[model samples]
Target: MQFGDFYYPLPANEPVLQYAPGSKEKAALKAALKQLKSEKIEVPMYIGADEVHTANKSTMHPPHQHKHVLGTYSEGDAGHVKKAINAALKAKDKWANLSWENRANIFLKAADLLATKYRFQMVAATMHGQSKNAYQAEIDSACELIDFLRFNVHFLSEIYRQQPISVAGIQNRVEYRPLEGFVLAVSPFNFTAIGGNLPTSAAMCGNVVVWKPAHTQVYSAQLFMRILKEAGLPNGVINLIYVDGPVLGEECFNHPDFAGVHFTGSTGVFNHMWKTIGENMSKYKSYPRIVGETGGKDFVLIHKSANPDVVVAALLRGAFEYQGQKCSAASRAYLPSNIATEIKKKMVAELKEMKMGSVEDFTNFVNAVIDEKSFDKIERYIKNARKRDSGAKVIAGGKCDKTEGYFIEPTVIETTDPYYVTMCEEIFGPVLTIYVYDENKFDDILKIVDNTSPYALTGAIIAQDRYAVELATNKLRNSAGNFYINDKPTGAVVGQQPFGGARASGTNDKAGSILNLYRWLSARTVKEVLTPVTDYRYPFLQEK
Candidate 1:
């Protein structure tokens, strides 16, 4: 069934699932599974009128829709960049003039539409297109999106209704308004919610946005746009495009009206964009805002006093959920030497109990990685682990199911060697590396965790003592933007947990308790007089 302008639902579960292993029912189910695996899930391609007219290289294939063509021009080429900026500038006036109430209502309605009517289709499409597991797709793409939209309305209300402060013998009143120019949103595919939040947050603040979603997540992005349009967002308020990185980057950074870029991706890309913006600083209409969240080599610390259950639960959720694709997904765990053996045993037993199967299988805990490239990357990491001279041993899950979609078993590595490549990189897969810390060399171990990673997106410390937790939290200060005490590093709630990171993670904190909307807006203060006074003498009036 069609969920929106861009989504279709998967076939339903049949009765053959009830059979025991190797039984007739099981045989039929296996055949059905094989057929499903073999089937090519076709996606629709949307084409821009200009691309169609120009007979450009962007025509949609049978199932793939060529939607999201980059702004109708070349990237970096001054003429085309100006054309795109002009298009956004032209759209900004009307979009900004819209009443805050109108924007809020529309956001609410659209969210409701997504949650109630489009949920299943969106879930299935995200699962198919982004290789998200069913639960992750549904929860993150649909449910979390709904939560974000609903929370956004509240955020807007707070921003708009902020009361003027009346200080003793001083007047302090603040009025917030949109940035006058356009915003450029460059999003990633890890969480489809980022697509909605990044652009929606900008539009919420009355900024016109030209959003470029990751190519891999085009379908999900298109479906989201369809929902936004259906909810009565003005035409051109959000301009969707599908262009490559270098081209679009040059265009966005070099444009005169390019107010800022809200980006979520790798550190290398973020750095490049930042450098581009810096290089073209003099050409811009204003100093552009650059808010981004990039890479993360997040960690989990298990103190000697921690509960085994807590460590196990946190690691399972943080490492394996979403196939460890989230920026905050746990990649390293530092354990005290005393509990290292027990923790490893618990982790191994827990991983064994964790089922791995198709995304649609509710009982399956581990799902396929996003695509073949990611699959191969994980395979390579496992191979690297095997080559480790010491300190690294793959305790579980070092195999790939070649016949199926990009599926790899969740891998756990036990190590004392600090130089293990798996321990150092972001990995971005379901490979959790455990390191044992010497009690006498605790400071040295902390230093290793702190300095080993280049990323500071997220980190967590599991300790029973408040002082130890605080000490560890302070020591690994550069680890992540959002640090956790008892919980896993992932699953940050929208408004309550404003998510984003420092260093390579992001410029603007996307979600959490922070005022992220400010990242999308430039403050505008409007003073309206209750009593009109004609041109009276002022202390600092300009001489005519």
Candidate 2:
């Protein structure tokens, strides 16, 4: 297998598993999903100053329906936020008190249920909501989530028990403890696996979660909740709500009962929430823990000694995968002048053959941007690029079909000018912009990349020479959370790649590892079997 080639099973043309025949839970969930689809969920609009004209802000080109995962939305204007939080809060004590084994069993059962019954449906929902083609969506929603579940089982089973250690004069021991209150998981729309695992891990650790999934991915989020409930998890153990960012984020930040937040979103919002918690630190009964993963303007640097084929393939996948919506997606590339022309030709040829169309088309290589706002951002960037003397000419695509869906052609821009906005900014689209640099300018190019963004999510360097590789790696030590060698920046595997970034990205590093679970909790020491026998008083315990 090639270095950057991650194995993902191609999605089957038909559903792989059937729901249990005539099961009440299945029937109820299906009915709720049907109702959600039947009702044209009000698309919140922005009212004009005159109070008469209202711009239709619902810009989802292919309008997506809410999923059946989290049950139905609340009937009134208040919606499900309060009710969901209350459910999780009410179940907190019972969930926390349950044996770690039993809690782990519930998750195990849920994982089994997901694998057997909802895998196909979940993939379908992810495809529908996020425009991730069937194969990619299945990999994210089913395959990856299953891995996370299995890993969590192993993680908890192996480590939940107390360990004993011998000391010269005393016995030493260590044990894991659960958080005192419920956890809040606010996930983004980009990755379905993250949307599930972020909150699920907290629940696995005996922390109840008040999860608010991204609005754009409501369906898949709802489906995940259903799978959890069907797996025999107590109703109040996992509370899910379909709420807007500002409203739910504010409630979570200000609530006295809030324990911790597992967030994945934009840096601006993450910063705002962090500031809010810091300002109101004393309002909570306990300090509210914060963990998050935010934005990235990740880069891929190719040294003069790098293989042309390897560089092209990695750059293509890194820049265009999931339409370049990933935190680790390669948004910029710095090519050594020696191979710059050859690499550009190969990339252009490969990208030219890439199919760009509706995500529903199984063969489509790239799909629509998430929404109109994102579409507008890319549009503005392209417009600005064109305005700049067409120096950064579109090498392959610049067309966007806005009739029925918001689909932008997978675009490639060629420009050596580092000053181009397209070269420096995180466009977050299937747009790859190349910047060529002379051999002597490699270090200077690294400096330019470091200073380009507030984000430090992920980066890669392709080189054949050991000295070049080591030098590039050392220089880019602080440039990314995940540094790749001769590989693409996309396709983070569960249990292997620890996914996160530094600087403004996020606080909680949700790297699909057991280590991330610690962020959802605080440490507590228990002195077990305290003897009545007299012992030497500790110097620290005794007042001086």
Candidate 3:
């Protein structure tokens, strides 16, 4: 394995499996789901080499089947957060000093295992725990995580190959060392890939990490942790813990060795953490690197030349897939008056036809949202939109039923007001709001689209006319980080579109790129002079 200098070419994105009927993948995943559902296991926090389970346990339930207990995870307090930090620090030196190729191989091996050995199980866990249907689980938990692992290894390799050019009889080198202290990775429940990538990306860069995944994601998060262990990750390199967010933050932010944090969640939480870290800056050994991707009130803009069918499909998939839990989901739309009627008619009809239920039944196009809190939040938004004075009329789907599980009907509201609260604020749910604009005033509408929302995470402009497309593109250039043309704003592939946004959305470090990897690294340049300077004097100092 150490025969020569390592060269890992760009890795391809993992192909998303379509678990169609009678497909082998479908059968395997069904089996995995059955197996997981049949057993109730006790999950523990992984601290150093130990599986730390406490009496304080929180039960895990399928979002689509709240009564069915998947398992229980040991909930920790500030003490466990402290332990995780200590574990990361204890393993820091060895993990950082490990051979670069070996470090790279561990992640490579993990990627392979995820793609092959545990593929079905991983997808199954996501489907059950996150309430994601088959295709949604495949694209997110399987394909995206696999792509992140493989592509990260390749990206880190490229980073290691960068060196300074040497002059005559002098050799120059730069060492991309891991940061002096530990990294804290706080990942959200929406994407299991982020839960895995947040910790592994830092650990892959020779920095040890303490990962605290959202409590709702523990079902799949624990599975990925096991895969990492099996893939030869050294103990304490990445410590996984389940704890109260504030307690964990209090401990980590106050610690002197808190090197950095890789985060993905809401803008409010991200802003709070930034403030906390800033307040405790003097306590840290070095300036802590804060990288985060926060909330998005993403948009979809329609033009007169846009195909009604295309707009309908884009809105259907973009707004309701995974119950519109995605941060990049198209929550708002600006439809041209010329084609808006046709698009709305088609969209409403399609929504009526789509089935909604548990992920167990693959035919269900819409599943339950994450949990009760999210269910209530989405319900509030729908209720507010229904008020007569709100000036927004529900065109289709505004039902919230939680008898069996937290389910919200895929709702669409058409409002005459452009900056209606539902359209401006972040609503992480199965709701889409549309505002009709004069077809000829496309440019003016684009300005409203740009200025309406504070978030600039993701957006799309659907148009067949080149001039209209170009105008919207130029006008809304800063409106979205990942701008799509004639396509839904969500579903950004890893290697193809590195995702993140600025202006309160996040630091825009652009995860899945070398830019994110560089945050975990601290560089040191060394220049060896073959001809040593005899004195600290130059020709000018010597009066030459």
Q: Using TM-score as the measure, which candidate wins?
A: 3
Model 2, 1-544: lDDT tens per residue?
Answer: 2243112222222232222457643453355334443444332211110111123232222322222122223211133456666677777888787766667777778777777677666766676668776557767887788777767766665555435755455555665666766788888889888888878888887888877777776657767777776777776777666557777766777778878888888888889888888998887888877888998888898888899999989988888878888888888888888888898888878877998665445567777777777877887776666665867877767777666567777777878587677776778887888888887777798788788777788889898988888987888788888889999987777767768888876653656776787666555554445444477776699775
Model 3 alpha-carbon miss at residue 11, Å: 1.0
lDDT of 1 by residue, 157-188 (tens): 66665657564445555666678688888898
Model 2 RMSD vs true structure: 8.9
lDDT of 1 at 266: 84
Writing each residue's lDDT as its tens digit, candidate 3 over 212-235 gives 999999999999999999999999
Assess each prediction's global lDDT (C-alpha) against the native.
Answer: 0.72, 0.71, 0.93
Query: Which has the higher TM-score value, candidate number 2 or candidate number 3?
Result: 3
Per-residue lDDT, model 1, residue 244, is 77
For model 3, the superposed segments whose C-alpha errors exceed 4 Å read 1-3, 535-537, 540-544
User: What are the per-model numbers of colliding residue pairs?
Assistant: 26, 7, 0
Q: Worst lDDT window (10 residues) for model 3?
A: 535-544
